[model samples]
Target chain A: MSERAQEGRTAEGPTAGEGRTAGGGHGTGGGPGRVLVAVYGVFALAAGARAAVQIARQFDEAPLAYTLSAFAAAVYLLLAVALGRGMRRLALVACGIELAGVLIVGTLSLVDPEAFPKATVWSGFGSGYVFIPLVLPVLGLYWLSRRR
Target chain B: MIGPLATGLIVFALVIALASLLTTALNKSMGTVLLVALGVLEIGLLVQAGFVVAALAAGEGPTDTATLIGYTAGTVVIPPVAAFWGVGERSRWGPAVIAVAGFAIPGMVGRMLQIWQGMG
Candidate 1:
């Protein structure tokens, strides 16, 4: 973790300078945008932590669900970083993938509960997560479009 | 782990979160009050972390020790990181970020309790 923090600090060094000059771009620099990015970051960490635990401890119990959990975590992370960095197009792409993932996974979980031995981040549109998964991408898309 | 202590931690976090949210909604830049609120909350979180670690060492926690410890450590770290970002931004969004971090602590603590109780 310390190593990762060190790497992140070094990586952020140049980008932070670039961000200063990139001024007034589509980055999530303001209040509402920062809130959205914060939510995305929270979800990323939550899903990623859950996936790590599930995979590390009980992979055999629900391999597919755990794998999907990992995937959702990755998508959340990508969207958060891209939006934070002002990569509007990349954020858009990530949000599109997230929306599709939620819809497809949510529907599949509902249609055949047995298909998922355990719940993933997108299960039932993230009911366990207060349905944020169902709504976040829509909000992301709206915010991205407005910023554009 | 410790019932009343956990409740105290959550309530404190929520109060700070609400205060931060109010600042953001009112379009105020992050202020001394907000920083003080966050500082208090971080102290509470660290105390909670200490209690959790002691309880775990006493063999009073979940079978999944790694995950439980991860959550405990994560909760303690979040406030400082959020504070750094919030203080750096100097915009309304700075408080917004702090609000998110503030809200997140309670949720993480709730989950940690669940994990400690073997609810997973």
Candidate 2:
């Protein structure tokens, strides 16, 4: 499957393929990139909607946690857009922030449970999310680094 | 939402996901059969969503309406979007996109079930 895709690209010449697909290159949001973008897009929607609702209904309950949720969503959204658009620098930064967020928030939620009245996406290293939140950033970084 | 219907949807979607993965592994693109399968999944999701709405309207559901609505909406929307995204690729990864959607639906639907059970 991948071999054929590579052949198609080579037959078209690198520049021609890039021009035709636009950002639809492996380094960007084509092939496996599409899967990554889809996952990130889902996370963005999930976290963003959850944060929006929490903030609207009861911001007083856990302002910091909801704010963090919103922040995480924003990062995921940025990463999705960056990867889709083939903006490596933007994707890299977003991935870095995501990695840092899950780790720091995960540890904080654990080491000091009282500080978090409610859970954020990063809380417990995204245990509530089956650790996808913890793993996604690392995957994003690896993908970006491997991209040509 | 209806319990058996939701659980059945989850199982069916998982099967479809595995099928999509098989297609990808076999170096095939997204085919009409898979698209129709996705359409079937979408129909099931819509039915589940409709039930949720009906239950909520009669005040026969959980107190966490906000989360419930959020998840329900997500479950309904993902399949079509994934289908559209998958169809655009014209490569093995096209079905891989479908595979992702297939997996996501079960998770979201299962969450809806849990929330509906008032376990949260």
Model 1 per-residue lDDT tens digits across residues A1-148:
2342233224333343444412322254433666777788888888888899889999999999999999999999998788777787889999999999999999999999999979998999889888999999999998787665
Query: What does candidate 2's lDDT look like per residue over B7-104, in tens digits?
Result: 99999999999999999898787799999999999999999999999999999999999999999899889999999878777677789999988888
Clashes in predicted model 2: 0
lDDT of 1 by residue, B1-120 (tens): 787887888898888898888887776667998888788888888888898889888988789887888788878887887787676554566788888898899999998889877896
lDDT of model number 2: 0.86
TM-score for each model: 0.87, 0.91
Clashing pairs for predicted structure model 2, backbone only: none
Give the residue spans of candidate 2 off by over 4 A.
A1-21
Instruction: Identify the candidate with maximal TM-score.
Output: 2
Residue pairs with clashing backbones, model 1: none
Worst 10 residues of 2 chain B by lDDT: B85-94
